[model samples]
Target: TQPIIVTTTTAPQQGGSGSGQQGGNGSGSGQQGGAQDLKEVLNSKVSKWGDANGDGGVDMGDVVLIMQSLANPNKYSLKDAGAFNADVSEAGGGITANDALTIQKYLLGSVTKLPESYAENIKTVTAPATTTRATTTTAKPTTTTKATTKAPSQASGQKFSVKNGQNQFKGDSDGYSYEIWLDQTGGSGSMTLGNGGTFDTEWSAQVSKGNFLARRGMDFDRTKKATDVGKITLDYAADYSASSQGNSRLCVYGWMTDPLVEYYIIEDWVNWCPQPQGGSKTVTIDGAQYEIFTLDHYGPTILDNQSRNFKQYFSVRKSKRTSGSITVSDHFKAWADAGWNIGNLTEVALNVEGWESSGKANVSKLTIDVSGGGQGGNTQQGGNTQQGGNTQQGGAQVQAGKKLCAISFDDGASAQSTSDPGYRIINALAENNMTATFFNVGSWIKTEQQIKYEYQKGMEVANHTQTHPHLGQLGSGQVRSEWEQCNSKLKSIIGAEPSHLMRLPYLESNGTVQSALYDVPLISCAIDTKDWNNASTNDIVNTIKQAAQNGSLEGAIVLCHENYATTAAAMEQVLPWLAQNGYQNVNISDMAKAHGKTLAGGQVHTRA
Candidate 1:
């Protein structure tokens, strides 16, 4: 069994041991409770197939230890077994005969529903061996000299001093005694937990106690305030030696003051490291208090990810509370885009109560960037990159998974409706079994036969604005007519109103559009194939192909209009080339799902 080590705490002062567990919790857990709202699959359940020891999960090696006490006639029963002097609750806590029956049923596949949470916090999953987080670590210095006992000194040019623990620190300290941890994808570092969750050992001196405390704001208050100060939770997975050292972790959460927001366990990390101490400062975390850690150790994926050039999905935070791995939907660009922009905010939000439940006011900070309407040559919105979750479409050979992409003909509209080139491209896509999104023109639906063929054959007939003008330049009412006219034409033929899904002529729109769209997500390209840029046909295909090769545009959102014949000429190579190179051409809908964007109410929207 892994050792259950606990974090040490300050005794009303730095390097001191106060008492029982801390009063509050981490900041990350509160962030994670929102996870339940964001997920499709639950990560909290244990794997039914992971009974490696062939024992029911709740059974023991540990709890059901026994010896036969035969009472003659070779007929022995557990009825007369000598019981330990523990209470009835302790005896009942051990495994029972009914537990065996449950496992037996589980293996038969009769077990359908999973429990609400994991058996115990969460276990560490060694991520796919193909993509290792650790590179070969340099060996520790070999010729070592005997060292003398002394106080734990901070590293040179050190920003903070260690109060009570030994070399290296981990976890947040409660006013009492506890340690929260951090994610360890970066690499290994020193920790603060001692043996068996106990911190009763003596420090070389009285000034070495430690804790990790940080402050975060609430949306309602926006006044830049501190939150519930508390210790983080840790789950040590694998043990390295007799000392029980293996994987170390921590959980962060949002805390509330006043009546107090019930704390939830948020995301946890396998390895937590120290932050740099350049412009370091202190803030109280909870009412009892804690020392907050900030930008020094902030290693969010978005802070470094680049958009268009880099695309991805996300995995679960690996903890007790999570339902399953979360894909921060392609529509939801946070760590990728949001994180980059958040770095520029000058003011911080204050901790407001009741935010843990309903907090739409907080997102107002985001609305400041939305343009009223009109424009789309280059983004005035600044290039921040996509959100960070897990890298998508992985290959043992490449960095991420097979990227989902699409090629739409928009032949139904555009001036080139009755052309031979676009028709030729359609045949090519069909022959290739390329599942494509085909947004139609109002004029094409007038051809009753072709309109029936498109809607019936599973080609997605989303709207491309009726007149195909820059809707951004139009007034809100005109934008409504643009969508309504297109919707009317499509409804006349397809017999159903369109969802008003669109890919702008210039692939443009503005903040003013929300009034027209019930809730349609705007489509934007991550990596435009750029075929319309007056570049040669080969240049367009080559640009995309080269991006796939150089591993830069792995999750590219290449845009091409079937309205052009050059795109048709290049289709032959583009499709086959991406496949030969191992790219998976999924529709926009699937890509959105993989990224964990919200699907409608039983109305799964398809946009590739």
Candidate 2:
């Protein structure tokens, strides 16, 4: 599907909880099909238009599908034909949260029937649920009269509650050092530091505001530069539940000497992130994009209670994730590239900070390490950075003698919304512990986050073309440009272009196309499920089942499109059936690798 791009403007301003970031929400006119008359769209009697899940009714489940699709288009999307019915808010407008809201209003009796332009009048409608994040412009207090530094307590569970002032503790556990700090103003909060990288914090929402920062990592002596502090990487997993009125941030927090700089490599946050003045600029680091912002703070600091000013440098992630590996030095390099000064490192640690919010967070796993030189720089803690044991596209070890099949999708990346087919397909594959290759069209690609999401989910992200043109009819130069541009975009997200495979648009290729992509292996399917033609889900499923029954499924590539709802539905049945019948679903590259076949470029790979 070709997504409609909407352009919006952003005004520079100070940090506050208004609209955090300004960009197209991926909802616009001219999607799925061109603009249609509102009356004709609403009066259609062919299908249950609003039934997102095809359950014969439009209900909360439909609303939920839309919401989940918006939040995570890769996993829960409405690529089915019913998506047309889901686009109710605006005639010919793509399926968006506005459509979800329209359905919600109908169910709530706010509207008797879905309106043609409900999106334009949704200004006063309060969302059923909302998360209130901290909008306070005040800086967190860094100095307290109750500051204390102590060795690791022999006791395992150490807890403290602060009502009005400040309490800070420094200790070491499991060969790693940690610090817990809390300061409240007209409020109260509590924190419990467990062994190693495990801790929990709860703050009072009844009062006005409070602050908490828990750190686990090396603390410098304000003598060495940030680069000299060594390679810093943090892996953490936590469950953070917050009230709607405050803010929560998970980051690599540190202070610097000489320049009096406070730096934050914010990996994730709750609603309303700190925007800083003059807005922010985008930068790519660690194979993902981040927004760089600088804010000035005037107040007491960690070193003293005297009023002083300092600059806060931030590397906020564009795609926020709760649990992941953070290469802290990548941000350091990015900041330096942006002409930001790197001062003497005073402290560097994995920190969880909450302000003016009544909520709780339980960190089940966390690890922070510094290599070159710094405090808490020990290597006693086992280096277990694997995230829940899921592997990347080529990282998974194939079991010997396992029946392997490749399921490939074309015409992606989908827009970041509920109707996105890529997300839905990715989620389904993940649920079954399988993976596939997404042959994404360059023009259809939306965000770098989408490509990153695919790779992060252990799926192969490949190139279809820049414009889905007939590569077989184009010159070699034109053909090269198509795949080259798409490869470049994918590289920006996943750190490398697709190495093992490329699929021609509509499988239409010739000598020119082959010559242009001579160094990139081409993938051909052994089985075709023509769900893109609006084939019934059962028919698509049967096509694959017949292939397996004929003993031609092993080491075969099963072709389909994630952009079709019918294809997604067929996969729901096909994946489990494949698994149950002793077939392992994998991407083309992995399938080849599993069979010990050398996937040389310039040759078409029809099977493992």
- Compare the candidates by TM-score and give the number of the best one: 2
Cα lDDT of model 2 by residue, 177-232, tens digit? 45555553446555566656567777664445466666665444333467655677
Residue pairs in collision within model 2 = 49-85, 74-423, 75-423, 80-565, 132-244, 134-246
Backbone N/Cα/C clashes per model: 66, 6
* lDDT, candidate 1, at 55: 18
Residue-by-residue lDDT tens digits, candidate 1, 1-608: 01111112211111111111111211111122333331211222122322211112221111111111111101111111111110011121222332333333333456443221222321121110101111111111110111111122321111111222211221111111122211222211222222222121111111122122211211111111121111111221221111112222222223221212212222233233233243322322221122222231211221111111222212123223212221111111222232311111111111111100111111011000111221111111211111111111211111135554555555464333534455555555555544445566565444555545544444445666677777668887887787778767877766754433565556554434533442343444434556666656797788777767765444334566665667777876687777767675544433333333322110112232
Which 10 successive residues of model 1 have the least lDDT summed? 134-143
RMSD of each: 25.9, 25.0
Highest-lDDT candidate? 2
Candidate 2 runs further than 4 Å off: 1-396
Off by over 4 Å in 1: 1-402, 414-419, 443-449, 496-500, 552-554, 599-608
The C-alpha lDDT values of all candidates are: 0.31, 0.59
Q: Can you give the lDDT of residue 279 in candidate 1?
A: 30
